[model samples]
Target: MTEPAQEPPFLQDPYAPYAAMRSACPVQSKPVDSGGRPGCLVIGYAEAREALADARLSKDTAAFFDGRGSRRRLHPAVSRSMLASDPPRHTRLRKLVTRAFTTGAVAELRPFIARVTDELLERWSPGERFDFVAGLAVPLPVIVICELLGVPESDRADVRRWSAALFSAGEPDVVDSASYSMAGYMTDLITDKRLHPGDSLLDRLIAARSGDERLSEDELVSLAVLLLVAGHETTTHFLGNAVLALLQHPDALGRLRENPDEIPAALDELLRFDPPVSTATFRFSTEALTLGGVEIPAGVPVQVALGAANRDPERFPAPDLLDLDRDATSHVAFGHGIHRCVGAPLARAEGEIALRAVLHRFPGIRLAVPPERLEWRRTRLVRGLASLPVLA
Candidate 1:
């Protein structure tokens, strides 16, 4: 059977059409833009990875949002961060901060993480119910990021508020205002650090180099912004989503409670079962590329289906089942190839601690409301639950 000319672009549920698109057309067309122009959406895991890591696919959305190949350059420094750029600029930025994401760096953080979780749990009352997201999950990532960057722990709340505003999916003004405020705060922090250099990632990054090569003033400021936003948001959703998964599946929770060793594997499964990132950030084609018989022209937008790819039956049998023991290496939750998430290690550590702590704090915890009443985040780009009430 031949694939249709296009799938509806507003699709939120990606399972059905994605599976069909995999065999018939790895690349399927979808109408985009205010003018209703056409572009390709890569469905298959192998094909999607190729497009994401391919040098020809630029990660910039500035041009797509504005025609004439131009952009205002949001002052928050995120637009200039590694997540949105192509090399050699991206190479330089990623290299400068790579040490912060190493395995050693994550392992060294375990003790501090344990303490963070313990303290949050201590504050909870056993018989009462509370919003775990607000009291625990939200603060966990915020505190960890602040400590990693050597930002004052006291400033985390304000910093996190600013962080959300900067990355919000809204009009240019909302984003622009948030960026300006965050930049001002970061600039002040960097200036203070320069006068009194400390043992923090940001301080070391300021001094990072490659045999005489160093990040410029602009890159330095931008890198700080990226670390702050990414440091909190991704893990924020990860912890929230993991809790939702556990409440939905009691058997999985029992297994983890019995054998905490399964936490790592379970973290991998949570990431695969319901990845925090729903799709890759916008990728613009540098040249015409065809996939599964569909053609995507230059400068057109292409979004990889991360959630769909994670659940692709071709890759994993019983794609909907949450198997903690499954080999999750193939999932595109962190994405594929060179452009994969640089913060995966830190995020993983946070997930392990978050889930283990959830079990410890809320023994026999259950959903306060029915699953049908649960409200998920409406935003299409980032997959997250709005709330998951827990009765401790």
Candidate 2:
């Protein structure tokens, strides 16, 4: 089995390693992301797309850790979520969620979203320097998702802290604690929602769980945690990446500024250019499968490089250039097939609103430090700027 070099391939730019892998070995057994688990990396566009849609490639964590003895399971609140389950369970969880996140439901939040964006912009005055992450990207989605989940405004900070620790590349003990704490918090929240059902998404879910035999208590808790985390993390990073991309490509930024109508299309291209979730969560083969002429054994984990596939020359012309007009709808940024991001509509809306507001508020916004001085999150699952200082 081949392993990546000691120095993490994605530390600075993951594309180089991804390009090399796509060209030299599109599908090869390799060490899994950061955790040193056995797996394969699929970088080619076609192969990655096929792998994402392949049913034989299971999302069950139990299948992955079946024979690992002591390393048997993840916290149920995370492992049982729709993202990590196959057909029946995933289908059930997604169906209940679809009722709450329909297009019309998400579209109705446009006014609330705009209000949040305007409120965030009020932080920066003319010529003031502010952190794009802290002032906008991070809090915007956090507040929106928290409100939707019926989380008390006073408790949002604690939720954010718990989430950060849960998703970080930190100590194992700390990660475990965060997971336990979040699981406990979500359980209590659901119990409270049952007694006091408000007109919120969580209330709807609680009703579904109680009224019909729609889901178990565990599934209810897991789904709630999934929505809360997935709702913000991807969008948060996408905003940071999108802003940085716009700053680097002045022509594209200028085009959007001149024609606000193009903001929607520009957001699509930005997602394709620099996806927030660099690689998909994880997929394991249920049986031996052949991909790119390589045979993957049953139970081996697989990670599809969504960012690399989005930039594949075969799939997108002038893959390296940031063309706001490019038709990037087929990009696997939100993933492919049934497992694609359920909150994609919300994320897109937030992206357009956030970028549009930022540009309008500060047409002169520019990076405060040299590009090389910027720090990237060290986790392999995501690609995001830790902080984006901007002079507006």
Winner by TM-score: 2
Cα lDDT of model 1 by residue, 1-392, tens digit: 23223323333344665666676766767654445566667767667777777887887565455564444447737665678888777777787777788999899998998899888878767767776777777889899989999899777888887776655553556767878888888889988999999999999887766663477777778889889888888788888888888878888988998888889877878888888888677787889877545676787878887877777777788887888779987778888877788889999998898788778777788877666555555443567655656787
RMSD of 2: 4.3
lDDT of each: 0.76, 0.83
Regions of candidate 2 where Cα sits further than 4 Å from its true position = 1-9, 33-37, 70-73, 209-213
Off by over 4 Å in 1: 1-26, 31-38, 60-73, 209-213
lDDT of 2 by residue, 1-392 (tens): 23222344466577877777777877767786456777898888899899999999999865466556534235788766789999877887888887656779889988999999999899789689888998999999999999888999887888888777666774556666777788889999888888888988888787773433477888889888889888898898999999999999999888888898899877779998999988898888889989988889887889898999898888998888999878988899999989999899999999999988988889988888766666677653778877888898
Please give the range of 10 consecutive residues that has the lowest summed lDDT in model 1. Answer: 1-10
In model 2, which residue pairs have backbone atoms overlapping below 3 Å?
Answer: none
Report how far residue 372 has shifted in candidate 1, in Å: 2.8
